[model samples]
Each structure stands twice: as C-alpha cells, then as structure tokens.
Target chain A: MKYSKQEYLDYVDKKSPDSPIWKNVLIAFLVGGAICTIGQGFSEFYKNVVGLSEENVKTAVPITMVFLGALFTGLDLYNKLAKHAGAGTLVPITGFANAIVSPAMEFKREGWVLGLAAKMFTIAGPVLVYGINSSIIVGLIYYLIQKL
Target chain B: MNKKLGKQTIRFANGINILSYASIAGQKEGEGPLAKYYDKVLEDAEWGEDTWEKTESKMQKSAVSRAVEKAEIDIKDIEYLFAGDLLNQCISSTFGLRDFGVPFLGVYGACSTMAETLGLASSMIDGGFANTAVAVTSSHFCTAERQYRFPLEYGGQRPPTAQWTVTGSGSMVLTRQGNGPYITHFTAGKIIDAGVADANNMGAAMAPAAADTLATHFRDTEKIPQDYDLILTGDLGKVGKSIAIDLLAEEGFDMSENYNDCGCMVFDIDKQDMHAGGSGCGCGAITLCGYIMDMFRAEKIKNLLFVGTGALLSPTSTMQGESIPCVAHAIAISAKGE
Candidate 1:
C-alpha cells in the first residue's frame, strides 16, 4: 500500500463526483407530492361522487395507487420515472406496488413457485416484517400503559 | 535467455499475432459513439433470448463465431478458447462456447477478463503450446445489474460515480501466424486494494491497480509514455482515468497527452446519461475489438499499451464491508514484431 487506507479513501472522495442531492430531492418532492395529490383526488371522488364511506375511501385510494403502480411497472415505465424521480416515486404506495410487481415480472421465467411467489418479498418482505413487528411493540407498550 | 522481464513483465520471444477480432454490442451500446465500429449490434437487450444470462451467452457465441469467420478459419482449427464473463460460474462463456467444442479455459478478472484472457492466450501461442487461440468476454446490463446491484425494476437512485455495465461482447483470434499488430509484452498485475469500499465507485477502486501495472510495465520494458501512440485502460471511467494520470505522474511518467480509458470512450457520457460512463467485461473487450482494432487496420497507431483494469469484489464481500481489491494487466501491442 503506497498510502494508508484513510488517505486513499480521502483521495477517492476528492476525485469522485458527488450526486446532485438538491436536484434529486426536488424532483423526488415534486413527484411524490404529485402522486399523493392524485391519490387525494381519487379519495375525494370515491367519498363524494361514488358515495363511499370514509373507511372505504381510505382503502380505495391506496388500492387505486397500487393498481397504477403495478400497471406502470408492467409497462416498464415506473423504473424509468424512478431513475430521475428518485425517492419521489419510491416512498409512496405505488413504490410498494412497483417493488413487488417488478421482481415478479423479472423472475417470471424462473417459474411461479420459487421464482415469483418465493422471491416476491425480496424487497417488501423486510419492510412488512419490521413494520408489523414495530407496530406490535408499540401496541404492547400502549396496552401496558392502559393496564397501569 | 529468460523471457521474463524485470518484475512481473514478460517479453514474448515470438510475437503473438492477432488474426481477427469481432465485437457484438446491444441496443444501448449501439447508440454510443463506437456504434459504427461494432461488427454486430442487437436492437434489443434480450437479443431474442429467454433470459439475460442466455442473451450474454448469445453475444459471446456471436463474437467468437464472427472473429473465427473473419479469420477465415474453422472453429476446430482454433486450439484453445480463453473466455469469461461477469456472471456467476462464468455462465456466459461456458453456455455460449460449449457447443464449439474447443478446449476451453475459463478466466475471471472482473472487468479485466479481456486482457487476462488475451494475455494468457497470447502466451500459449507464443510459447508454441497452441497454434491458434481465441480470447473472448461478455457482460450484459440486465444480468450484471440484477446480480451485482439491485433488481432492474427496483426504483433506487444510482450515484453519479456508478457506471453502467456495458451490454456487449468482444472476441479476438490470435495465432502464431499473422501479418501485423502483434502482442509483444505482457505485464501481469498484482492485486492492490486501496481500501475503497464503495461498490458503486469501481473506477476509484481499480485506479490504483491500473497505475501500478502501468508503472511496472514502463520500468520493466524500459519504455516511456511517448513510446506508445495510445495508452488505454479497460474501464477506469472519467474519475479513475484522471486519478491514474496523477498517480503515474507521481511515478515520473507523464501520460496526460495520450492516455484514455475504454470506459470513457464507449459512451457519450453526458448525452447518454451514463453517470460514470461504462464498465464491465464488455467495455474493454468491445472497445479494443471494435474501435481500436479498426485503428490498427487503418494504420492509425503502431505501438499501443492496453491495460485491463478490474475490481475484484463480490456482492457478498461488499455486504460484509470488505474493500474492493483490484488488478490491471497490460499488453503491449505493436504493428511489427521484433
């Protein structure tokens, strides 16, 4: 080693270009806000025009977004949008839909059982596991407080 | 009497001649600057194959067959086939070339497989072990992305330092007999880990190794940067190319005038939106086989220093927080053999 690892890392940091975080963040914010706005539109339509209950509207809005996400992923447009949109497209329900559908479509050749069914959770499985587990922990803490 | 030069360099007594070479590029590569030089460019990434791995295999097969055809020789006439790819178990080379029934040696040097295979094949031919040999390597954008990074459809932002894996293949037929453009020397690189841990910034990881091998080649061959018309590295991209230039300058070798990287040459980085240009086995392979070989045939260059750089890190090793270990092999190609 001509230089220490720290020195080499410092040199690499100096040489390598950094990603445009501000641009990415702005795009992500706009795209995310747009997606949410569309979801709100759907929510309003279902609640007023379709005469759905508040609970039904909540379910209907996400279902519609997930459907659009899966549809865009199937059409192979979501990833392209996400390329520039970054977290704007990824932090929404549509992103969750894309996460599942993308791998499902990709692994379709590997067969349905192991490829599609098994590997479907490659990205979403961790989120589900942690989300549910943390919610359970929070519920338990509330339950203890109520008992006290 | 010894063929071995100072340190890790080998001066081939009988110059290994490059008979013919071919390059097969995918749709993305076809849109690049060297698109016209490629022997064949597929309009689709899948290449009508069922899978990306199979598509990579098809590319290797096409490149090897084309090179052999251009050489005006039957596949059986080729004694050995040195090939590899970015896929696990080198599936692209094995599955692609298996039907050819040529004696095969699978090599692995990450993106440097082209130079590694070429160097080994040239040695075999120069040492009279084989009359003719073929060196080939391929990499697919789809296969490499899914295997090395994330799912193709996974919506994750790639850093600016991230390089697009080239979807292409290149093959060269080398023999004991040919007109010109002979491989005169081989400098085997030592694996050097400069402790770059980021997997996305491969150029940074591999730059130090490229510099070391180039400096060693110059010292062993008693040649300077001015001796070669062009000094090309495999896939060091923009960042690594500049870093390599600085590192070599520190070693008292000024390469600023004639130095370029295959990574930077293959793609129109700004226009194509290729963040750090191109990388992968195919980057060096196709650039050498397509554009560089055409330059040789046109007599644009005489002496050339072709260095293939590779970052040796697996997804598992990277996840384990291991730094990328890199190597670069240099092959001196000249228009005339001594």
Candidate 2:
C-alpha cells in the first residue's frame, strides 16, 4: 500500500536539511555561477542577434533561465541534481529555467509545434504573465517618475 | 430496512474498542525486534546522526503513550494487540509492545496494515469473538534504510517523486459494543496490475492500485465521489493524484475538489519541507488515527471514506521483474451516526 523507496526518499528530503559539504557547496557555486554567466551571455546574444535592446535582454535573462531550466529538467539532468542537492538546483536563479524546460520537455513528446511549443511555457506561464504585467506597471512608473 | 415506521429505533452500531496496541520501541540498540533476523542486511543499513532505533523507538512509543493517554486506559488493561511493521518480524511494533503484555496478533499487509488490523479487529467484534484489540504498525528509518537502500552513511541520492518513509507508529483501541469510533463498512480492492515496474517511481507504480480501488469502491458501494466529504487514498502523491483525476474523469467522476491523498496531506509542505510526499503504513495510519480522528470527533467531517493503497509488490517480487500488484482497502469512518 505504501511505496517504501519513494516514501523514504521523501523522508530524506524532508528530515535531513542541507548537508554542509565542500564538494556540493562548491558544485552549487560553480553550476549556479555558470548558469548566471550563460544567462548574461544569452541576454547579450539576443540583443546582438535578434536586435533586441539591453532592457529586453535584461528581461530575457529570466525568460532564458526559465527555458533552460525546462530544457535541462526535461533531460533529467536538473532532476538529478534536484534530488541530490535538494535545494541546490531548486534554489538557483536557473530553477526557473529547469521549471520551464522540464514541463516543456514533458509535453514535447506530444509534438513540436503543437505540444512542445505550446507547453514550453506551461510551468512558467504564471511567471511570464506576472513578469509582463509588472513590467508594464514598473515601466510606466519609472517613466513618470523620471519625467517628473 | 426502511422500517423506520414505528419509532426511530436508531442507536449507533455496537462497536469494538481496541484494547491495546504495540510498536517497535526503537532506541540506541541499533536493533529492532527483527534486527537479529536482518543480520545479513543489518551491516549495510545506515542512518544519519539520528539512528534508526532513535527515530523508530521515539515514534513508536510516542504513539503508544498518546494512545494510552487519550483512551484513558491503563497499559495492563489492554487484552489484545494486532500489530505489524516493514521489518520481517514487525519488530518496532511487536517488540516495542512486549512490555505492554497484551495478547498479540501479528499481521503483514504492507501499507494496508491500518485497514488490515482494523479489519481483523472489526471482524472479531462483528463475529462476536474478541471485544478489545489494538492495531499497530510502524517503520523506522535506520531499520528500513538497511533493508531497502544503502546505509545512510553511504550517502546516495534518491529519485524524484520519492516520498520519505514515515518512521512513526500509531495505535488505536477497539472495544466491543463500544461508545467511541466504529468501522462501518469495508471494501477491498482486487489485486490490480497496471504493469508499472519501476520501484524508484512509486507514485506511478501505485497509481493504478489507487485508481482501481477508487473505481471498485465506487462500483461496490454505489457511492459517488461526492458522497463522502473527503475521498482519501493511502499514499499516492502529487503525480498519482493527477493521474487519479484523469482516471476518475473517465468514469464521470471528479475528485478534484474534496480529494486529498494521505501522502500529500500528512505533512505541511513548507514546514516538513518534503518534496514529493510520504510513504509507509504510518503515513496513512497517523493521518487517520491522529488528524482525521480529531476532525471526525469534532464533527467537522460527517462521513468519510479512507482508501489505503499498498503496492503489494515487494523487493523480491519486483526484483523478479514483476509488475507492482497494488491493493487498496477502503473503509468508511463516519461520525457517531450518519
């Protein structure tokens, strides 16, 4: 009636907090740092390649992380780390990337255009919506404040 | 049956009081009742700073103490005990209760033990056999770790969608023609195989059992999902819960609203910080014996159906490449009267 391994895994995740280990701590720093670096690179690339502005790239960093996260998540690489580090992959700025990539990957099998593309944003759709909404408000406020 | 014509001669059903219960009283011994039996694997079992004996004994006895306190019954008064655990001999439950000195009935129904014990005790009362009996089951981390996974000291990663094994225990007292809680009906699920063999992903592995039991429960009882205020399953986590919604929808039932899984419900996500969910007999048992009973006693929920799902496929069975055969036993725990 109960899944032992599954349940035990849950217990491990819950009861044991983050273990202080040099290997994992360093791994978190490196991987997290690498992801951030990639985000900066992507933002610059998008601005240069797609003719988007710096501001657009700034916004795109989060969007990029969300996409990359989903991609890695789908590949199960992020899930592996998420399982081991518990909060490592989950706590990163790239967690949004894993989130988006995972769901998109999950649905990608339904087909690229219809399934993958449509659901690519499923997990992060709320974040996207909130991002867009808040951006509009923030931009308006910033412009008004600066002009005044 | 509709002979309510003369007088509303309606009195609650004569129920049984569970006299005593037992569990693995874990400690620093690093061994449970079944420890000797697990000699081969004991060397491999590991725990964190918290030893298996510690968590298990602490959990098992805590429940024993709580049950004694709540029931207001002295330990010696308990007439019988029906108990089990994940261990070979159900040590944490059996050995822990050794001092309680109640007549014991050992049962191994995997995660369906709560129902198994309750079912056994209920039948004893219904058949006019025994009046007082206790049903208990417990699982400790150290003991379970050695048996199932690498030693905690080994430090290995777990899979996604994995739920923590509950190391706690719960005991209930069932007395004959009693004034307290009574088990109304029992509906057991058939041994169902959906051909899921992955042991790591138990949520998917146990999904069919949960769905099938839910289906069978609805089929056998002629009760809709809406009939009960809460339709609870033993240990299907978020993944299985999603699948259940889709499965139930095929039968024109939607459990999206009043539906909660014991695995998902037992712990506070933020508080316990559990990722996917919880597992083991205690997951559902404690939830029922602890949380649900309190709500039921307070008249918060009038009628409830608890369907505890268990993956009958063991390590040996699964290692034999057998698809998980899951079974769920459904029991109706209602208020004093409907």
DockQ values per model: 0.77, 0.03
Model 2 chain B scores worst on lDDT over the 10 consecutive residues at B3-12
What is the Å distance of residue A56 in model 2 from its true position?
55
Clashes of each: 0, 39
Q: Which stretches of candidate 1 lie over 4 Å from their true place?
A: none
Each model's C-alpha lDDT? Answer: 0.93, 0.63
Per-prediction TM-score, chain A only? 0.96, 0.50
Best by lDDT: 1
Q: State the lDDT of candidate 1 residue by residue for B244-308, as single tens digits.
A: 99899889999989999999999999999998889999999999999999999999988899999
The sequence of per-residue lDDT tens digits that candidate 1 reaches over residues A9-122 is: 998898889989999999999999999999999999999999999999989999999999999988889999999999999999999999999888878778999989988888
lDDT tens digits, residues B146-257, model 2?
5554333221245545666655566777777555556666665567666666665566666666776777667655678898888888777766666667667776777888
Off by over 4 Å in 2: A1-148, B1-58, B270-273
